[model samples]
Target: MSTSPSRVFAARLSGLPVFDPAGDQVGKIRDIVVVLRPGGLPPRVLGLVVEVFGRRSIFLPMTRVTHVDSGQVITTGVVNMRRFEQRPTETLVFGQMLDRQVTVRGTGVVGSVYDVAMEPERSRDWVISRVALQEGSKRFGRKGQTHVVEWRDVEGFAAPDGVQGATHLLAALDEMRPADLANVIHDLPPKRRAEIAAALDDERLADVLEELPEEDQVEILGALDNERAADVLEEMSPDDAADLIAELPPETAEKLLQLMDPEEAEDVRRLMSYEEHTAGGMMTTEPVILPPDATVADALAHVRNVELSPSLAALVYVVRPPLEPPTGRLLGVAHIQRLLREPPSTMVGHVLDSDIEPLRATSSLEDCARHLATYNLVAAPVVDDDGRLVGAVTVDDLLDHLLPENWRDTPGRPANPVRIGGTNPGGSRG
Candidate 1:
């Protein structure tokens, strides 16, 4: 405890790299684990929520921590790889504590919790020692006064009342990827999840919703007003938006579609018309489609769009006139790798890989899978009976349908819990 920092602010600990004794980075700190006590006692620190590779969150008990400073946390090389599940006795410092409304005892000042500080006591156990509060500003366009006081001086942490805002928590997680943010939201209480979801902008919310489980997606979307929900759906990929709408009641789905932009709603409706397990059902209508006359430079520029998923960007669909979905005759596809080798001015049609057949709209899931595997393709075009390109199916789409419905809820296999210095007390159960 003496070697670690005397006081660590919870906000600063967010995303700090955690390493093992040999300098191998195991994960990054996402949140702190603590247990609240009675009689206004400081909450005892249990461990940390470390997001390891693959975005799996695991519990790293304080006992396994060798050093903790501003730069990074050093842990005993032996650690458990089991996913972290919140027990009833545990509370996440970052997820549940930040942005809580509180009051200073014996003082009329009232504010919201922005951050908390942790320090080791005489018993050599880390505990929440201080609370950072920000008062409401009286003047426009200016922040309120900030105060740092002992944990005992705060009155609301023990029994929080009123709705807690997500501003501070969102700030701490501002740089997180959508998938990672989805994971964090998945673990939070439903009410808190709704709060955070409401705070996110439409585009960000759409991305996070796409990564979340279907049930969670429905719940969060249901919480929003009709107009906002329709806007969020419009921000999602047409195929994804269709899938989510399909889960809603028929009336609700129709109402949302009516509220969406005409063009966006048309795309979603077209995707919805296909059978769920067919190639057209799973294909994205927004893949990089281009006219046969386009140059390699144009193809590359379109694929280079930062928003395009890697699999979708792996190939450019070459077609006749009418560049939008349901485009005229499917000419061929220009593989990104081959396009990279050709000169920028060369026409995509000249270098097309037309030998590989395109998938029909009615093709079954198994048929689509075999086509991709046989051709060693990441994505393949889907066409209608008249040979017009309707959409393109990527590997990710197939896997989503192939996996178990609850695959997102499943945890990884357990790993040995042997610490470099000693045996881990928490074992693999963590």
Candidate 2:
């Protein structure tokens, strides 16, 4: 452990890459595991919650760690592939400790815990030794005074339950993808999950909500006020928002729909009218769309939007007048690759691949899947009875509907779990 830093701040280790003794990258550190002692003593560092490939979180024992630095963590080359499950006796430093309100022992001053420091004790065991606190601020944009004190000097970690701020936790996870953030939130206690979900902004929450399990989505949305919930619903893709809303009580769903913006609400309502497994139900009303007369450059520009998903951005839906969903008529689609090769001034209609038949709104899930697979398309247009372009069904959307309802809860695992360095008799697999 000579190469390990003398002390490490938990906040700084949030997403640092974890590598093996052979220099193979394994996963990134998500959270630290610690066991609290009964007396007023520092909590013993147990291990780390490392999120491996497939978004499956696994435990990496401290004894297996060879070195740690600001940039990365080096392990003994052995990692348990079993999913990480929090034990009743253990606490997650980032998940359960950060943003916790505590009082100083001597002064009556109170503040929220932002970070904690861990160091190796005389026994060569890592322990939480320091706590960083930030007092509540008076100004809107300014943070209050911050203090770093010995762990023993802080109080309130033992409190049964109360509201916890998500500032620091959110900051530590700010760079995480929505799906990854959703995974982290999915593993938290119910109370903490709702708290963190509520703290997220409407757009961020919407993106995360779309990635979460249906039950978790319902629970988090249920925890929000009607107004805010409606706002969040509006932020989600129309199909996703409609699906989630359908899970709610009829009355609640109606209330939320009424509260949402008229235009957004209309899209959700139209989507909800279709059967769950139909093309109309699964398609996104906001795919990259362009009029037939539009130039290749215009189509490319629309697909270039950073916010659009890769599949949605891979093709431009060419239609007649009325650019919105249910547009006048479906001309065809122009693949991004094709658009890139064509002259910028060329009209998209001239290069359209209209040979492939479009899917009807009533097309079954199987039909939609077959259509995309046959044409080797990432997405296909969905049209109304009059052959007007209504929306586009993407491969991702199809897979989301085709997978088991609980597929999100069960992440894929490697056939053979990786193991290196002789097995440790003391290490817990999870």
Candidate 3:
């Protein structure tokens, strides 16, 4: 489903018209624009080929557009209509595209890559992925920050110096979360957002969803296939799950739910019962659960077999035996790593910590943070009054509840660098 930046760029420029800034009718387009190719490689145009005086054909840089929509075209303010004249075919607008990598700039506050894209119909070309302004490494020094501008953003091929310098992009992209990625998309140009969305895989899309604004979730989800959408939804917390499902059209929601596992669907439905943002609404039902009498070997086997998040294996929950307690009462807790260190024949109940901290269905953020800090715990199990384990909350999830949106962007601040994909960028400022 993801398209390369070059492909997206080419698609956006094809049908768009070249206009003068004042809503003045200038001329129509003619041919394709090229960016980033070397000498004899390809001449990058901002956009299409336009015939201005109904005679001569001119290369219309996609960047010259003031407004682009299905209804009409508006030209760039930089071009004066009265003095304008047609140019030769060899003229290139995006000269810098010949051999350069430009990163997209984040909006004023959001930390994420900016999308870059050209209008379609101009010519079939690749769209640029979002630009990432990232600081390479602190040890390399802050000056190591660089912009990753994509070819899709090259509406017109001007010299590299002609492009506006986006300064805020690097700090913002550093250590951004999924929600941050979503927020960054909102600040970028529409063409850019579409390009980034088109480039991401299902799992990457899911990661971005966790950071996206709640209001924008459905629209983005609508952009994805039902299978990918369902997969991403399955990865989200129950509270976010309810918010997104509620926003989708009923039929769409139904179809996606059908595609999801029955248990996951049920959990989402249960979370939907409570109002948005409530403890019950936010709690997930996918916590790792094991029986009290199960041996350490059994628990380890369960940990290895079950599809739990990586964070979950660090902290697992032990519940009462289903046979002994039909309702599934909470027994104690065990650290997966700690359990592994013990003998395989050891009983889970014996190794489990009975004094484990637990959360009620209605615990507040403050209560959870304090518990996590006080106990030095990674996560806490949520148990109902009947002593049944329902869900668990990890420190990472709780941090989402505690951290500010742009905490890492603060200047001169040291942060624990976080990584996206499998690459570790090391720690960054909080």
Candidate 4:
């Protein structure tokens, strides 16, 4: 039987893999170029600029796309070096997607968005996405045969900063996993990552922190506010959080810790005491939690408002409110969709299944994986000896441990991962 249009498109694109019509491997796509009305409107793909030889870029029109699969983008032909375009004035590929936001449609309503990715080969040409949105990718918890929309399907581009058309894409962009983020960051030069770190807003920074490496977390933290830093740290894996804190100079760390809530700071301090890379060292103090009596509405509210981990609300731990001590006891797990469905007044305990599964702070990656496999869970709660929820580990977090160093090189990762430091290196204004 013939595949439906969507499947055909997805099949042709998902498994096809992207290649430069110009045949230049270095000129990997930075951003998928789209034609947009100067004013706000849906954008359409015009072409793609793949980084060819170092700093040299080649443009591939939408026609160049042969297929896109969950793993790669296949092109009709190799890009010729002669066809490569010169680098643009900007230093980063993401610079091309700046101030712009576009949508990708799934079966019906908008599915997600086309966020930024980096093209290091052509440093000047930052934008390059011949196709948008990959399905069956865990980066965003996407499943099924990955589908990709060509730039042609996109609406108009958002205007650059300060313009009315600048779309607010924080939610869509932040939905990716930390490993995905790390892949994006790895594609860019370390300096560029640090620079981008300094330029990102608090929300963006927090989003990035969940996915960055230990080295990057420190470098970026130095550029953010004590409060912002604290906020990001609060949501991070305890080990990851403590690692960033330990990176801070003694006085600086102490001062920032002082600015943080005593409870939060104390938790971090305890994690800090553990050796880095160990389970106790790497676990997080913060995880999704709901009072055993909390209603689905209440859990939903926390997911939307409280901001646990960036792009992670897969697992919500149901815990009893402390009577003896404020230990976050484990009760049940609530999926985001589940939490959104039931009435706001639905008590968590009543809705919650008693078959609760939990992980320990001292568990190894192998152990974590075993729990995930046993429960078929997207996220598993990490608890202390008393069964108090200290943090929760999402499938994404565990996946990060298994991925190769350069996740971007593999297909299904975010296309635009790098965030360049703009003209203003010291500020996070953009």
- Full-model lDDT for every candidate: 0.89, 0.90, 0.53, 0.52
After aligning candidate 2 to the native by TM-score, how far in Å is the CA of 180 from where it should be? 1.1
Query: Worst lDDT window (10 residues) for model 1?
Result: 412-421
Query: Which parts of model 2 are misplaced by more than 4 Å?
Result: 413-417, 420-430
Clashing pairs in 1: none
RMSD of each: 2.6, 2.0, 18.8, 14.9
Give the TM-score of each candidate.
Answer: 0.93, 0.95, 0.50, 0.51
In candidate 1, residue 387 scores what lDDT? 92
Measured with C-alpha atoms, the lDDT of residue 178 in candidate 2 is 97
Model 2 vs. true fold: TM: 0.95
| Clashes per model (N, Cα, C within 3 A) | 0, 0, 77, 55
lDDT of each residue in 170-212, candidate 1, tens digit only: 9999998998899888888788888898889999999999999
Q: Model 3: what TM-score?
A: 0.50
Q: lDDT per residue, candidate 2, 87-153, as tens digits?
A: 8888899899999999999998899999999999888889999999999999999989999999999
lDDT of 4 at 183: 42
Candidate 4: residue 34 lDDT (0-100): 44
Weakest ten-residue segment in model 2 by summed lDDT: 414-423
lDDT of 1 at 7: 91
How many residue pairs in model 4 have overlapping backbones?
55
